[model samples]
Target chain A: MSDVVIAGVGMHPWGKWGRNFVEYGVAAARAALADAGIAWRDVQLVSGADTMRNGYPGYVSGATFAQALGWTGARVASSYAACASGATALEVARAEILAGRCEVALVVGADTTPKGFLAPNAGDRPDDPDWLRFRLLGATNPTYFALYARRRMALYGATETDFAMVRAKNGRHGLENPNARYRKAFSVDEVLASAMVADPLRLLEICATSDGGAAVVLTSAEWAAKRGTEKPVAVRAISTVTPAFPQTVIEMPNFSTDSGVAVPDAVTPFKSAIAAAAYEEAGIGPEDLSLAEVYDLSSALELDWYEDIGLCKAGEAEQLLHDGDTAIGGRIPVNPSGGLACFGEAVPAQALAQVCEVAWQLRGQAGARQVEGAAVGITANQGLFGHGSAVLLSV
Target chain B: MADGATRERVPAVEGWFSIGDAPALIGNRCTSCGTVFFPKASNFCRNPDCNGEVFADAELSRTGTVWSYTDAQYQPPPPYIPRGDPYQPFAIAAVELEAEQMVVLGQVADGFGIADLHVGSRVELVVETLYSDDERDYLVYRWKPLS
Candidate 1:
């Protein structure tokens, strides 16, 4: 596919909007449209990350935002990939633009999460795996992140200090991001002193459920030239890939993992597997990446991404961090926008927000927290329950 | 079921499990490419390559090692918990059973908090009752250190 340029990007500073999701979505969409220098009627397609709307059809969300944006008669679609929802929406929009389906496509993701621990939908139904996991087993979300954190500490000699440093590093950058939810820098002591939610994980180490929104506008490279004649930041590839077969070791919101009983499971662990797919499609390897925006749901998970995304050798992420490689102004800086740790979990909007950060850094437009001379960048996130997404962008 | 409140041990849906300690968990295996799915898939196979009837009954390992473990700090809302008040925390873990060469996640015993777990720790699986309310009951499985 030809390159799709992200002509315009926008966000309604991620914090509790306490408003309907569609409204935040519309506001972000209009902001993106304005940034693209395009009128509302100029866009031809729209896509959105699906939200859990009570009394909705299939949980689809695109048309809702379309209607809120005044029903411009744009071809619309909705996508859901757990935490990776925003990137999935971006993928669909990029596909349409590259396939010659539409020149200007708007991608938006927004959500206002309900208070309390995220649980599965209602119904006595054992038939639905999401509900069954929660119904049969009271496995909450943080427990999953804690599981991975524990695995890393064991396999990689990762220390609580390593995890704390992640928070410290990201918190420092987050303090600079006006769009970030948590702007105050955190101390290693603060992280350790926080209440323990899951073993080895304190409340400070985990991301909170948040209400926020982000949006971006995509158009063909040809369209980009026609509009402004300068080199626009192009979306080189989008990878909304899924997990390999026999998904063993229960994921979040599940009682247990796939039994791996039917056959030999695909060997690559889930996150790295997704990165491999993205790299293959984008025609670049880890060495090619100037920086990355990874799904940092937890501090340990960020280090895990260093391996999964090939930022470093397996089990070497902690040392890489210690070497000051991933920190801003260091080699291959990561999560310069502070990630979910600083931004808070906005569900669907989180991934798209990552893409926005990449676009800014690639164009050398990011103000205080720019990755110096960053060019080629990638954003990797996996939405739980079989929805995977990744994107590679270049200037 | 000892509690007067936990939901009945009614399987939310049918065909997810067979009755026994050696209870071979059943799931849909793709007939075309021989791919196995857990939590059972009666629908299509998720294999990136082959397209075929994804149906099969597969047995999972009954025992495994602790890949990792954590505990709930806040109370989980229903359908995870039937009743809500004075949120009591619980332990959860991911177990790596050598036989299946995969990891399984579940709750650890009620009191096993984060301070009590480490990676590569040995654990065993056991079917345990979750909530037992008046009309129906709920039964789930958990993993604890083999010690």
Candidate 2:
């Protein structure tokens, strides 16, 4: 497979901006186009990540963004995979470039989220599992995160302090990130003192929903070379895999796990399989990663990713945290862009933002958070239902 | 009989759980593969290996061990009606049934909180009133710790 060069990337800073989602997308798209030194009319394709909250326009995000930027007869496609929407859009653009169908493709994702826990569309539908979870058990998203955190404490002897440390580390890492919404550096005590939203996960440890946008300009290596683009960061692999059934882990928006009685459990659990496919395709191991930008929806989930992405053994993630191996200056920094911990979650825009951060780090443009001499980076994120996404990039 | 005292009781989600003293979750077992699904898979078996289109109602084991547990500290958004005014938070648990080898999530029985539950603790399914309307009392399954 030919490499797709990340010619440029841009973001509309994550926050409760309360503006039209299209505005964020347009701003980010224009910035990315300007950064790439390419005109919007010159682009051959526009791939957009869809958001369900914004009515018809969000559903047709590809056309919405294309129209917002003024139509240039670019072919458009939109993808929705909940939080993994951005990566899904990126995959769509990359596929077009690799297939020789389009030399230049632009990927964008933006969202304007509502306040409080993201609930299912107002309804009395009993068949929708997402609604059933909220109606029957009042299981908010934080409920699931707390369940995982409590289980980690029980299974691996991880403590609340260990989880709080993750928040503190990311807080410091994101302090210098201009695009981050919450740039305040938090102490472990401050995190522990915050209101408990769910047992074992305090208010500060959980990510909030925000309004933001992210976009990337991708071109074939030949196209980049033709433009004399020097030292372009290349996307080596993109993985959007689904869980093999009998999925034992209780994922979001689901009431029960698949029964493992009839079929033997899948060899690699859903989260582990996400990055494994990326590494296999990129022909690189976790040891080859200079940095990573994982979906830290909760502080504890970040620790979970350390093990899932093959950075350490299953039960050894806590020790990795204790040894400062995952901090910005550590052996392999994870979430050097402060992750969702700092950015909150802009849902559709998040996964692309992860790639944007990785691209910046690879290009040695990550400012103070830069991993010195950073070369290879990977991003891992999972969305509601069974959407699994990971992208691998190298200079 | 028309007063609130004698309101008719109905399952919040019909066919999901049984009524009466002994409550067991109603799940569908794939006849071909013996895979059980809660909320019942009627159209097709979810087992990727099995192409079985037939299903039988399976009464899941009433008792199971707690896989994990947590409590909601705040009231969730709409579609979830608060059981009482001022919003009393409730404990929730994911129980692992040995027979099904699958985890099912439900609210901890009323009056039970996180302190009463632990991983590997035994629990049994019970029917409880989730909320009541003017016409009927909606019933749902909950997990009660087995002393």
Candidate 3:
């Protein structure tokens, strides 16, 4: 199949919107269309990354956005994979473009998250593992994150200060991002002083949920050239890969990780598998990445991403962060747009937004936090329930 | 309602059971591949190649070791109802069954504190009523320390 180019990318700035999700989505979509110098009526296809609203999302999301945009009738698809929703939506857009079903397609993801922990819906549904976890165990999202973070600390000799330094490092870059929710720089002392949310994690260490929207307009290379765009940002790979079977013990949204009772064999952890898939598809290795954008749900997770994405050796993420190799102006800056830790969790929209950051950085348009001469970049995020994801973007 | 479960009640799903003389704790065994599943497989087998007939019937081992544990500091949103009025923080755990070779998640029994448990600590399953009234009893499972 042919490669797809990202003609335009846009977002409605990630904090709380306090309005219906459609508005932010439409605004982001309009911005993308304007950026591409194309009219809404001219778009041929639509894909949406679903952000669960109330309970499950509305079935007709494409039509929902279509209606809000005054329905010009485009081919529509909606995809869900927890946090990876954004990249998955983009994947669908790229598939349509490559399949020749549509030359120009729009991929949009938006969410106005509920306050506090994103709990399972209200009901007594035994079949539903999300509700079962809450009804039976009262395991909040933070608890799971704490389990993983604490495990990293134990196995990797990663310290709380190392975790705090991740925040301080990201916050330094966040201060330069006008679109970020928390742009104020933080000190290691400040992170240490923050109130504890989980055992080793403080309030500042974890990302908060927020309302945000992002959209990308993708087109075939031929379409871009025809539209007089000299160079369009290309998506090298979109990894919607899942974990292999006989999975090891790990905490998931609704259940404890699957047991490996049948055999002592283990599958690659979901995070590493995501980056590996991206590498294979792109025909590029980690060394080619000029910078990276990763889901920093917690400070520790950022460190985990460093290892998972092959930026450092296993259990050596702290050393890389300490050496400033993953910071702005360093060897390979990570999360130069300020990751989820600083920007807060926008759920669905966030992953698509990461690609937008890559596009800007690769185009040398990323002011302040730009990785000097960045040509290749990668974004990594994990969706729920076996849905792990990443995107390798190149200029 | 912080006050009364007497207002209304509904029976839990029939096939799902935590504990009983019949031995509860749901599971699914693949007829084609003999792959076993816990908490019972509702539909087909998840195995990619073996489009097996998934039979939803099996009893889980009562005794196991604690894989890990943690507590929820905040109240969870809907679909999940907190037993006590409003809601209070409570502990959750993963118990590993040697026979099943899988970890199952459950609430730690009441009065079970975090300090009382550690990974590899022995534990067992128990059928506990999460919430009940004259009309219905919401039966659930818990991981209790093996005494």
Best by lDDT: 2
Interface RMSD values, listed in order for every candidate: 3.0, 0.7, 2.7
Per-residue lDDT of candidate 2, residues B33-135 (tens digit): 9999997998789999899889999999999999999999899998998988999999999999999999999999998999999999999999999998878
Evaluate model 2 with DockQ and give the value.
0.88
Please write out the lDDT profile of model 1 over residues B1-147, one tens digit for every residue.
Answer: 466554446643466555555544455456777655556656666655556654666766666777777777766667776443567777877777665556766777654655666677776656555665668655556665666
Computed on alpha carbons, the lDDT of every model, listed in order, comes to: 0.78, 0.93, 0.79
Question: Can you tell me which runs of candidate 3 are displaced by over 4 Å?
Answer: A54-58, A259-267, B1-28, B54-56, B83-88, B126-139, B145-147
> Residue B78, candidate 3: how far off, in angstroms?
3.7
Q: What is the TM-score of chain B alone in each candidate?
A: 0.74, 0.97, 0.79
Instruction: Give the per-residue lDDT digits (tens) of candidate 3, residues A1-395.
Output: 33788888788888876777888888889988887888999898889888777334434556667778887878899888788988988988888888888999988888888777777655567677777666655666777777667668667788889999999999998888877888888899999999877656788988999888889899998889888864588889999988776666464674645545443444567789899999999899999999999999889889999999999889988889999999998999999998987778888888988988898888887789888999889999987677778999888
Q: Chain A alone, TM-score for each of the models?
A: 0.95, 0.99, 0.96
Interface RMSD of 2: 0.7
lDDT, model 3, position A91 = 89
Tell me the number of clashing residue pairs for each predicted model. Answer: 26, 0, 7
Lowest lDDT 10-mer window, candidate 2 chain A? A1-10
**What lDDT does candidate 2 reach at residue A32?**
88
- Give the alpha carbon lDDT tens digit for every residue of B42-61 in model 3: 56766555576657467777
lDDT of 2 by residue, A215-326 (tens): 9999999999999876688899999999999999888888899999899999999999999999999889999999999999999999999999999999899999999999
